[model samples]
Target chain A: MLAFIIRRLAQSVLVMLFVALIAFIVFRYVGDPITAMVGVETRLEDQEIMRERLGLNDPVIVQFLRFIGNAMRGEFGISYRLQQPVTELILSRLPATLELAFASATIALVFGLVLGVYTALRPRSFGSAIIMAASLVGVSLPTFLIGIALIYIFAVELGWFPSFGRGQVVDLGSWRTGLLTESGIRSIILPAITLSLFQLTLIMRLVRAEMLEVLRTEYIRFAKARGLTQRAINFGHALKNTLVPVITITGLQLGSVIAFAIVTETVFQWPGVGSLFIVSVQVVDVPVMAAYLMFIALVFVLINLIVDILYYVVDPRLRVDGGGAGK
Target chain B: MTEPLLSVRNLAVEFPTRHGILTAVQDISFDIMPGEVLGMVGESGAGKSMTGAAIIGLIEPPGRIARGEIWLRDQRIDNLPPEKMRKIRGRHIGMIFQDPLTSLNPLYRISDQLIETIRTHLPVSRDEARKRAVKLLDDVGIPDASRRIDDYPHQFSGGMRQRVVIALALCAGPELVIADEPTTALDVSVQAQIIEVMKELCAEHGAAIMLVTHDMGVIAEAADRVAVMYAGRLAEIGPVRDVIKDARHPYSQGLMGAIPRLGESLERLVHIPGSMPRLNAVPPGCPFNPRCPKVFDKCRTHRPATSEIEPGRRAACWLYPGVTEA
Candidate 1:
């Protein structure tokens, strides 16, 4: 088991390397960063000097190697638009995106598991039918469209929440105090709901089907025949057996969430790695963009590793060498 | 005579199909007395499992008891609500499936499953449950019961898993244990060991068993009385020795001749030639009519009512119409 886990850990390192290589190429080779930095209004002469200054005139390999070197040393150069160290700007904005992602994921998991099992338990019931219908519609709607619809309903029309921002750093003081305050929490509600809908629907559908299939298996039938309550059978036996698949799906979706979160951040105007990524891309701040890209990639690999570990914990069949020839 | 532990009277089960309603079990009736092992022998698709599921009220949606009276200890249990039936199941009437591995929850430890059954019916502390679980596992012949109780179902061998399943069913000390082909999935050698374990354990607990299987050899060895089901109806029922040595129903005879034995000639094993009738298209009178070698015009258009043959034997066939119980 230990050897298998160690091997899996090595595989995770490989994934990070792949992500880093792709990110580096995308940041360096695609389009001129200096043109974006100089803007359409800047003179060609000034642009040349800026290009030379930033070492954009160098070969792609030389530029990438230097970028990788500086990145490893925590020097993300400077933010072109923010006029600050790329690391400082990234660190400041990172909290908002992470907070949003965490909140959304929590919402998705709670609703998904609950509604999923509930529907599986009573698929033909009116309440379960309604939840199934709602989830289908929820899954069909695009994330951007959901965001816009949410902004209108909760922020504009309902007047229940703030449409944008993690709230001013000046107004709320520290991140600790900010979350505790009424305004900060209220601001996060709309964006969090919008982000969770698609993910929640996907999880609920998957969980419902997986749970139904498990319950039909002999083990579940025996559990029932043993006079275990319906609740015990559904939650204890059926749900636990279905979790490995759910975990894998959740990890993969979360990786996608970190990628597509930019659209949500853009809509909500919330400051996180997502909006940081967008601003860096638009202003051609390759250093900050690289920092954000690496962070997301690192998160993806870490989540996958966590999923594999959890799966082994759940099923000994997943444990290599734990069950010799039991495979 | 003491009131039987389980009395299933005129039970019928049906389900909605695309064409129309289909009856799975039609007016089936049987009784199980405490400490008596009743083997229900049948071909595949004989509605044997469905009958057991109906008795426990685990029949899910799209399938329901059309009309029935399931009497357990003077209580008419068929119409009882789901919660009530669920309580009765694994408590008064325990069940084991054909597959031992699948009969246990993959996520739970053996001890947890055993204790869960106990706690559901009777109030018991976790420590008490654990203590009882170890004893129950020991009773079922699981090795290292004291130490291995914490292991999951996947950790145990197939026969051992079936033992655990039996232990689970017997944990609540149920009056009636319905084993739906409990040893069907085990190896030939292991099958005998598991069945031996189950019979001994059940006898020790004074539990009546409704053992469903197609194997007459198993029925001959384990059962006191035997029931033969063909299609959706009971074809014959009597003492096990009578059913095996002198079966009243032709279908039962066919089943007996079906299995190959050493010293038997290379002649074709007698099989009821035609495919078993589908639920919706069962014959008007006798379910086994089409396959019966002595089938008559009356057998085709009119169903024959079950008639008593001897003191304890009853058969649903026209041949037994004039036989008087003496």
Candidate 2:
């Protein structure tokens, strides 16, 4: 198990390196940082000075090595537009995105699992049919549209929440969160719900399909024959089997959730890394863009690693080795 | 004189599809006395498994009991609600399925599955249930039962897993067990071993078993009384010896003839022509009329009711009308 984890960590590093390389190439081709920074009106000599200062005069490989070295030391160069350390800018906004992601995932998982199992259990019921139809709408509608609608209803019309921003952040010694204050919690409600809507539907549909399939297996029939309560058979036997696929999809969806949060962040104006990403792209801030790409790739790999470990914990059949052979 | 342990009177199962309601098991009736093994032998799709499923209240949905009365001792159980039937399932009636791999939960340990069944039907502590589970496993011929109880279903061999399934079925000491083709998925060599274990353990617990199988040899070996099903109806039922030696229904006679004899070097095995009809196309009269050599005018137009041929023998065929009338 330890060897497996170490191997996965090595793979993750290789993936991050590939992502960094791609992001570097893409950013270089998209626009010239010098033009964005010094402006088209600047003198050629002044532009040359800026270029040399930023190490752009060096060969691409040399500049890439320098970026990698500085990144290793937690110094992701200065942002071309902001003139501040890219790492610090990203770190400041990281909390908001992380808070939204965590909240949305939690909401999606809890409600998705409950509704999914309930629908699977009483598939012919009117309530289940309604939930199924609503999930379809949830999947079809765009996130930004959902966000705008929620803001209109809950913020502009009802005055129950602030429509935009992360509200007030409370800094504990090591951890910082906007969730501790009432207005801060209220501010995140609309954006989080908007961000989680699609994921909740995806999870619910995946879980409901898996559970229905599992419920038809012979063991479930035997479970009923064994006099287990419907609750026990549904939750204990059927739900556990359904979770393997659900967890896999949930991990994959988490990656997309972070990706899609960019649109949601723009709609709600949440001060998160997604908005920072948009700003960086618009201003041709290569350092911040490259770092963000690598960071998101790293998160994807780590989530998948955690998912693999969870698979081992949930399924005992996978634990057997060659020693169990020929028995 | 005592009431039969389980009585099924005119039990019928049907499935409702877009076309219409298709009858799967039609007006089948049988009784299992205490400690007796009633072997139900038939071809695939003969409704033997459906009969067992209906008894255990585990019939897949859309297919339901269209007509029947199921009595467990003195209690009328067929009309009970699902929760009430569930309470009776593991406590009064246990079930063994065709495939052992699919019968046991893949994620649970044998001990956990067994103990859960034991505790569900019996008011026992976890520790007590665990002990009983281990004992049941040992009784079903699992080696080092206490230690191996922690193993998952996949860890055991095919025969061993079936034994564990039997142990699971017998955990609550149910008065009756419905084993639907319990040895069908096992290897020929190990099939006998599982059958031996099931027969011995069931006798030890004095549980009446309705053993559903298509293997005539198995029926001859394990059953006290044998029921022969044709399509969706009972063609013949009698003492195991009588059914095998003096089968009255022509379909039963053809079935006996189809089995290969040990000493006789026959040119070819006697096989009955044609297959069991599909539920939608089952003939309006006797289900076996199309396949029977002695089929007559009355057989082609009227469904024969189950009638007593002798003191302890019964068959559903127009040829036995006079015997039944007497």
Candidate 3:
């Protein structure tokens, strides 16, 4: 097990390096940071000195190494547009994004599991039919559209929530959160639901398909024959087996939620790092963009590592060293 | 006679599809007396396993007990509420399935699966259940039961896993165990051992077993009585030795004839002509008529009802002197 974990960690490091390489390429090939930083009125000598100080004149390999090293220490140079240290800017906004991602994920997982199991257990029931039909909308609609529709309904039409912005954030040390206050919680409800809808449907469909398949397995039939309560058979045996695949999908989806929540963040004017990335892109803030790329890649690598371990933990068959021996 | 532990009266299982209703088992009746080993033998799709599933109330959806009744002792179990039937399942009529590798939950340890079943049916404490689970495993011939019980299902060899499955079925001391081809998926070398373990364990617990398989050799070795089903109908049922040595029904005779004898130098084994009819295509009269060499004029016109061939034997064939039309 220790070897397995070490192997996985090594893989994660390789993956992070690969992603860092991509970020480096983006930093190298994209519009010049100096051009984005200074106006046309800046003197040529000043630009040359600035480029030398930033080590743009170094060998490509040296510059790439410096980029990786700076990324490791969470030190991305000042954003070309914002003129603030990219790391501090991202860190300040990290809490909001993390909060939104977590809330949406919880909603997605809980509702997804419940609805999936429900629909699977009663595939012919009216409620299940309705849920199955409604899930199509969640699946087909774009995230921005869902966010806008939710804003129009709950925020514009009903006036129950604010149409835009993180409301009434509270600080826990250096971390700021909108989760503590009433307005803050209400403010998150729309964007969270919008962000969660697509994932919720995807997870629901996955769980339902998997749950149905698990129910057909011989073990479930044996469990029924063993006279276990329906609840135990459905949840304990079938659902537990179903979760093996669901965990992998859920983990990947969670990484996507954190990394690609850009559309929902933009639609609701969410003050998360996604919107910050968008603004940085508009102004060609290369440092912030590269940092964002590296951060998202790190999130994916960490999540994939955690998911692989979880898969091993949940499935005992995977743990056995040798293939199954027939009697 | 001592009361039959289980009774099925005119049981018929049906599956309603878009095409039509398919009768998987039709008008079958049988009794399993206390501690008896009754082997149900048939060709593939002959409804042997379907009968077992029906008795346990596990006929999968779209298929159900469309007619008749199943009784465990005096309780009419065929129509009981699902919850009530669930209580009776592990507590009264346990089941072992075809494949051992799939029968046990892969995620759970043997001890957890065994203890859970024990606790589900009996009001024993967790420790007590664990102890019984270990004892059950030991009884089924697993070495180091106490330690092995902690291992997951995949860790054990297939035969050993089947032993675990047998232990599970008998854990709650169910009065009747339905073993649906329990050894079919096992290695041929381990087949006899599994059968022996199942028979011995069921006998030790005084649990009547309905062994469903097409393997006549298994029936000859482990079953006290043998039931022959053809195309969803009972062809013959009698003492195992009597059925194997002197099968009364034509289908049973052909079935027995097909099994090669150790010393016989026959040029070719006897085989019945034509396959068992599909559920939707079974003829109006006797289902076996088209395949039976004994097919006669009367066999084509009407269905024959089950009738006594002797005091303790029955055959649903018109050749039986006392049989009548349904």
Candidate 4:
């Protein structure tokens, strides 16, 4: 088992390297960040100096190799727009974005999983019908539309919060000031709720479908006949086997969660990397945009690696590293 | 004779369809004696398994035991709530299904599954459960029973897994064992091995058994008394020797004729004339009227009750030598 984990971890490194390489290529070749934002008064000489300073004048292959080398050593260089170190900007803004993402996914997972299991248990009852209908509405509406819909009702009509913008994190950064502050937590609710709606639908549907299929299996019948308690049968026997794909859904959806957060933060002005990335894009700050894009992609790669590793913890069958041994 | 252990009287199973309540098992009655092997023989969808599952209170919803009483020893168990019935299921009545490969959980070790059964009703310590698991495995003829207890279901062969299932059923020390086509999923040769092992195990434990199967030869070899089902009703039942050699019901006779003898011509072997009637649209009178060779006007219009043919043998047929005079 340790050998299997080691092999998987090694593969995770290869995936991360491949991802970082693609991000570097796409940041440079796809669109010219130089033309989109620089001032007209900036001299050709000054531009050349900027190019040399950021290493843009270097060979593309050489630049990519250096970037990977630096990343391996934990240096992300400096951001062109903020005139700050890239790692510092990402680290400072990362917590807020991560906070929103984690809260939203957690809410979705707990709520959706419960609703899904409840529906699957009853199958065709009235409660299940309502859950199915709710799931339909949850999935059918696109994320941006849901975000807009929420903004209209919760922010505009209800006037429950500041329309946009995260309240200053400085005061809250200190526990002396931030403890259960009305402004700190209230600011995050709409964004978290907006992000959770879509993931909830995805997770709920997946869990319900997997649970239904597992319930029909002979082992389920055996469990019932084994004198194991009902709680044991449903959760211990049924849900335990259904967890592999739950982890997969959680991991896969984290990417979409971040992506959806981009639009959500843009709409709500949540103090996160998503809104920060958008600003860097509109102004075409090449270094900052490159840093942001690369960071998001790396986050995705790492999440998937974690998910792959967790598959072993969920089902022992996949832990083995060989062909199926016939009894 | 001592009172029979289980008495299922006028048992009928039905499902509510769009048209109406369609009866599946129609007025079947039989008794299971303590320390005896009663073979339940029928074709697929013959209600053999429905009887087994129903007797254990595991019948799926919508399909209910419409009219009947299932007595265990002296207690009527048919109408009890699921929670109440669950206590009796693994404690007093044990079961083994046909698919050994799937009947045990893939996620659990054989020891874990068996230990769970032992601990559910008995408050034995983990060590005691572990010790019992090893003994049960050994009793079922598994080699390296102590070490192999930690092995998963997939780690064993088809026949071996069946033995594990039998061991699990007997782990709780129930008085009656219901082996529902326990060897049907095994190779023909392996099937014989499973039957022999089950017979010895149940006899050793002094537990009566209801062996549900479709194999006539298997019933002949394994059963003490035989209950022959047609569609969903018990058409004929008697001591295994009498049921096979002197079957009174035409349906039972037709079933015996269907099995080809080793020395007999395969081409000349007889087959039942037509399929059993669909549940939703059973024939107006007899459920098997369309296929009964001895069908008469009365047989087509009114169903025959299970009248005793001799002191202990009974069959639901108008043609039983002194049967259905009414």
- Candidate 2 residues A1-327, lDDT tens each? 677779988888888778777877765666887887776689999999988887878899987777677767778778888899988888888888989998899889998999999999999999999999999999999999999999999899999999999888899764569999998899889999999999999999999999999999999988989899888888898898999889899998888777668999999999889999998888778878888887788779889899988887888777755213324
TM-score of chain A, cand. 3: 0.97
Q: List where candidate 3 sits over 4 angstroms from the true fold.
A: A321-327
Estimate TM-scores for all models: 0.92, 0.97, 0.97, 0.93
What is the C-alpha interface RMSD of model 4?
Answer: 3.2
What are the lDDT figures for the candidates, one per model?
A: 0.83, 0.88, 0.92, 0.81
Give candidate 1 regions above 4 Å deviation: A34-65, A168-177, A319-327, B323-326
lDDT of 2 by residue, B237-260 (tens): 999998999899998899899999
User: Candidate 2: misplaced stretches above 4 Å?
Assistant: A321-326, B323-326
lDDT of 4 by residue, B1-326 (tens): 79999999889888888888877787878899999999999888878999998888877788899998999998999998878788787788888888998898777778888888889878899999999889989988998888888877777888999999999988888889888888888999888888998999889989999999988889999999999887787878889998788788888888887878787666565888789776666676667788888888978877777789897788877765666632
**Residues forming the 10-long window of minimal summed lDDT in candidate 4 chain A:** A171-180
lDDT rank order: 3, 2, 1, 4
Q: Give the per-residue lDDT of model 4 (tens digit) for A37-116.
A: 36799888877777787788888889999988887776777665777887778777777788788879888989888988
Model 2: how far residue B213 lies from native, Å: 0.8
Docking class of 3: medium
Ranking by TM-score: 3, 2, 4, 1
Which one wins on TM-score? 3
DockQ of each candidate's interface versus the true one? 0.52, 0.61, 0.58, 0.48
Residue pairs with colliding backbones in model 1 are A97-A272, A218-B102, A219-B102, B285-B303
